[model samples]
Target: MEQILANGVYLGSQYAMIALGLTLIFALMNVLNFAHGQMYVIGGFVTYTFYGQWGVPFVLALFMSCVTLAILGALIERFLFAPVIKGSSREESTMLLAAGIAFFLDAVILLVFGEKQRGVPKIVDGVFNYDFRLIMPYDRILICVLAILSIVAFIGLMQYTKTGRALRALAQDRTAAQLMGVNVDRYSMIGFALGAMLAGLVGGLLVTITGVNLGMGGPTSIKAFMMVMIGGAGVISGAIWGGIILGFMEAIGLALLYQYGDITYLLIFVSLMIFLAIRPQGLMGKPWG
Candidate 1:
């Protein structure tokens, strides 16, 4: 039971991070980023290169990847995504463009990294064991702590600061925000950057547990999409909730279904479908105005 709970919480944090990125991007741009997972993949690779290969401190490697991914995200927004948003019907175009970007990045990673999976050595190797039953590792503990801090910081940014106000305003109403001189374009870029940073951070963290490979992005992206939908579209809090639920479900599935890992996702899909059939806007989503 303790083991199950620990795995659930650890996985929940990763899912929340991924879901948060997707929600942030969707809230601002009114489009889903098909390539967002690629950023996560690249982030893990960057950390592997630094911490695993160059012998940089693990925390330092994470920081380096965070900064690099932020810059890369901004560049992607400016060059790849921004151009498509100007079209008469940008919702579809932006999504398609992002899909194109994801495919291209996947190919590039495959060519560069090859088919081999890469591992990130433990930053610290020790387990917290109590009563010979409860056990937790330091790295997973760190993942959860960082996840909490990131969520808190994200909420603070959205609620308290000036730039955060601008982002909130843009999300609530782009045309009205523009009329109020909020600069939707700039805020959208910032949102994308922040979202990408979150995804990259998760990627780096997950490499410690799941290792790094070209295919990691696809399943993660799908799970994130499920989280965003199940939690509630355009609702950050919903993503967090959805992530936790999904994580717990997966953990339980592992305990009960054991050998049927795929059943977990199938169950999630069925649950989501049933929920949507009853409430199309999602768990916390307000009907589109």
Candidate 2:
């Protein structure tokens, strides 16, 4: 029980970070970024190349991942999504564009990174064991702590920064924000970049634990979408709650169903369907338009 609880907390923290990025993008642009998981995989690859292969410092590698993804995200928003949003009459256009972008990124990843799994060296060694009750790896603990700190920092940025204020204003109402002197195009790009950066950050953090591969992108995106739906579409706090809930669900389910041979995810999806049917708005999310 103690181990399960500890595992839940660790997994929940990282999952929440992933969900945060997806929810942030949705809140700002109303676009479901199917490429989000690809961005994450790219981040991990960058970290693996630098920290794992080239002997660069881990911090520097992580920074490079964030910068690379941020730039890519900004360029995608500036050249692709923004124009499509303005030119298209159908909402499905954006979804289609997102799907196309996901495919493009997947191809890019395959061409550049190949199909092999990649990971980084653990940042810490040893395990934290308490009389066989609650045992965890030191690297996992460090990553979890870093993820939580990142979350708190993100929340603080949203609540107290000038750029955050501008982004929030844009998200709340684009026309009103423009009327209030906010640059909608610029802030939208910034929001998308920030979201991508968050995805990269988490990917870099988790590379030490789970590793990453080209095939993980689609499933990762699906998991993030599930978290968003569970928490409430376009709600930030809901994303966090959804992530934590899903993480614990995974932890407990896996622990309990290890003997059942991969039925845990099947159970999770079934539960999610039931939950959504019962309360579509989620725990704290208002219905998004």
Candidate 3:
């Protein structure tokens, strides 16, 4: 039971970290980026190529992956999102463009990497024993620590920095923020890039625990979307609350059914229904205007 609880916390932290990027983008852009998952997959592939294939140091590879994705996110904001928003029908065009990007990236990945699973070499190996009875991988502990640090850094930035104030202003009202000389366009690009970087970081971390493949992003993206929705669309705290809840729910459900056979999908569906019906605004969601 202790092992199961520990494992659940570990997995939940990863889920929360990944979901944070998605929530940030949603809050700022009000667009559901279906392609966020592809960015994650691409980040893993970058790490695999640089570190796994080219013998680059793991830390450097991780940095490179994050930087590359951040640039890609900026490009996407400029070319893909900006145009759609400037068009006659912003909402429809934005969704379609994002969906198109998702499909295109998925195809590109399938062509380049093929359909095989590949794991990123572990950053740290060996296990730590607690009370000389239970053993857990150091890697999992590292993931939890990273997750906590990331969350703290994010919250600090939002609370203390000028850029954070701009982000909040934009999130609340873009036109007003622009009127205040916040440079909404530039800030949007930066926000998008930051979002991508976060996703990539989560990707690198994931590679250490689970193997990566071309098809891995789709499901994870869907899960992140579900987490965002359950947390609330425009609330940062909602994302954290929703992600932790979903992660623990998933972990507990899996453990419970490990002996009873496969019921993962069913459990997920039930949880979703219960959350939606009981707390449609989510645990930390702000009241809608």
What would the TM-scores of all predictions be?
0.94, 0.97, 0.94
- Highest TM-score model number: 2
Better model by lDDT: candidate 1 vs candidate 3: 1
Runs of candidate 3 with Cα error greater than 4 angstroms are 131-133, 287-289
Q: In angstroms, how far off is 51's CA in candidate 1? A: 0.7
Off by over 4 Å in 2: none
CA lDDT, candidate 2, residue 289? 49
For candidate 3, write residues 90-186 as lDDT tens digits: 5777788888988998998899878899887777899999885556889878878887788889889988999989998988899999999999889
Backbone N/Cα/C clashes per model: 0, 0, 0
TM-score of 3: 0.94
lDDT score of residue 100 within candidate 2: 97
Q: lDDT of candidate 3 vs native?
A: 0.83
Error of 3 at 263 (Å): 2.0
Q: How should the candidates be ordered by lDDT, best one leading?
A: 2, 1, 3
C-alpha RMSD values across all candidates? 1.7, 1.1, 1.8
lDDT of 1 by residue, 43-153 (tens): 899899898999999888888778877888888887777777875464678878888889998998899878789998886689888886778888788878888788889
